[model samples]
Target: MVLCTCFFVPPLQAQESPEVDIGGALRFNYNLSSWKPEQKTRGGDFGYDLFRINANAAYKGIYLNAEYRWYSDGFGGGMLKQGWFGYHFSKNKELQVGLTQVPFGIQQYNSNNWFFNLTYYVGLEDDHDMGIKYIYTGEKTEYQLAFFKNAEELRFGNDSEISHSRYSYDVAGRNKEINQFNGKFIYKFGGNVLQRIGFSAQYGSLYNLDTEESGNHYGLALHYEASYKDWNLKAEAMNIAHNPENAASTPDDTILMAAYGAAYEVAADFNIYTLTLSRNVPVNWGPVSALQFYNDFGYMQKQEDDFEDSYMNVTGVLLTAGNIYTYIDYAAGYNHSWLGGNYIDDFSRGTPNANWEARFNINIGYYF
Candidate 1:
């Protein structure tokens, strides 16, 4: 979400203050979800969520950008989400360095749901990497090329869960990218109705702590998006493959062991598909301003034959008024995570005779 709070220096204080752009946002959420069998887990299904601060400035031809985030679960511990500095040679070209988002997938994604899609958790989309990047923007096309040194390896606490890296959420658990290369190209066409087609690719050598071996991770994706009237539609399909070195040598107690138990294989290749549709409606009521309705569906299938597919359906609504925003969503997953089994088509919810696992979630936030 883009939020900005502007400040103007008073005439009396203008001489003592420097002109700079700054803004930040505060977010609080009370979540109600069926996924929580016990309500007390993770702050009792509702609590303060996030606080973020952003600043951007440019002097001469050099520019700097930064963002810091604090999570409620961390007791308000600060995390440098993004910090980068670059030289703006021209309006359409620039080179950036530091910790930033890897430009391999769509920005803002294609979902209105706060949780995003499954690929996000898998580290294929909305993942950031510390790297150096060069970008080129033309009238009808934009291109990005980057070489990332690592795949987000910053840690804080000693606890494994709390100290885990953000960008290494793949199933294999070996997500420490020793080295990586990423590139994406987007081309736009059509006149009245804007249309865009894009391609993205990434390659990384992920380090495994158990065997101390590095695995190869690679993926390719094709996506399309169109905007018309109040409707925004998006679709993407991708193939992600992982090749772990010395898989048989891994001990039976690590994450690799669990991954082996789930897939019954050393290496895995999977195909994932995502589709999203959203519409905006103007509204006039008390504090209510505008409304957005959206639906996001995602499906994943193993490349191997006879492997079942997993899917999730998310439907949500967004309400925006001034700097305040609220989102309410209903999500259902079938044969998808551990809570709902690992495969598909069984219509079983991992339990003996259950159907599917469903949850309702809501988030409220305000920008300052």
Candidate 2:
């Protein structure tokens, strides 16, 4: 008994157990551009310096988990950005509450990767409207079931008091967009094999503030991913069906438009890629981006193409990018819409609008 106790005690003293790691970064950015929406509205031209900031916190636990992002851009209103609380059953599965981006369409990708979030990418509105989600991550398959408030009709304010939303709803029929209960589901199978298939759907009508439009709709996204050697083929067929009976006129309709794109890992540090053609859509701010006012703009070649020209060569909006302490969070790179022909949007139409001129951004994160 004494020999056994001594051996076990010595091993225990030499080894350390596992606990959770908790710390987050303060994403900072300083912009010198003309297109930063806030600057545009503030009477500052292309050269006035603008600064933005964001903060995050995480608790990686087995039973509980949460993440929030706060950023500011000087405009577009504050974002309730991402506020969700979940109870984990398995390490990769859980039940969630609060504003959650429904796991739909290329569920593996983040909200930023998609072309348009306004589409039924998730159960609609980037927030929670009496919603719930269930995620099951199996060894060979991953599944998601989400139910949240859908924009049934167009309403103004956040008058969700009747809908059990903790936030106040404004009467937004004429001035805002709202919807009814939106629901979605996605199932992904196959590992890092040669290919994988996934299916997703979103159903609801738009209603905010209060006027429920005459058109009610549902959206379907069929996604697939496969590789032939180093070449990866990723595609999606997204379709939306609208019921004309719900509307007064012909109910401006859209349908069967989807994703077709591919990526080829040319080497370890680079990849050749292309995506389907799509139009541009605008999105407002959230609680997080609002508070941080931060943006991230990567390296740019001074636009001074001519050998003799040198008067602020780069003139366009810049996406002041943020960085983590040890790794470049370039994956979660924030986006900004710059004016001039160098627009990030699919369509470069009317980008150099008004007096908006060329803009650029620089990051001096730690103001020491």
Question: Who wins the lDDT comparison?
Answer: 1
Pick by TM-score: which candidate is best? 1
Candidate 1 regions off by >4 Å? 1-19, 35-44, 74-78, 155-162, 165-175, 209-213, 251-267, 304-308, 338-354
Clashes of each: 0, 70
Against the unseen true structure, what C-alpha lDDT does each candidate score?
0.66, 0.34
TM-score of each: 0.79, 0.45
**Candidate 1, TM-score vs. the true structure?**
0.79
Q: For residues 1-368, what per-residue lDDT tens digits would candidate 2 score against the true structure?
A: 32123223221121143344343444344343444567766654322222323233234432223333333333222233345565555455566665556554554331222122222211222333435677666666766666665422222334441211112121121222224333344444544545667776766553322344434555565666654433444555455344323233322221111111111100001111112221122334331111121111221111122211101112122122223211111111112122333322211111223242444343333211
Judge candidate 1 against the unseen true structure and give its global Cα lDDT, from 0 to 1: 0.66
* lDDT tens readout by residue for model 1, 1-368: 00011112111111233335788888777654455656635544666777888888765545678887776443425566678887644566667888777886677565668768866645666565678887778889998888888644455323221234232243334434558888899999988788989999988886665566777878898989999999898899988877666457553222221111232122256778999999999999878889999999988766645445567888999999888998888878765563244332221112233456777778888876
User: Which residue pairs show collisions in model 1?
Assistant: none
Candidate 2 residue-wise lDDT at 115: 21
> Candidate 2 local accuracy as lDDT?
0.34
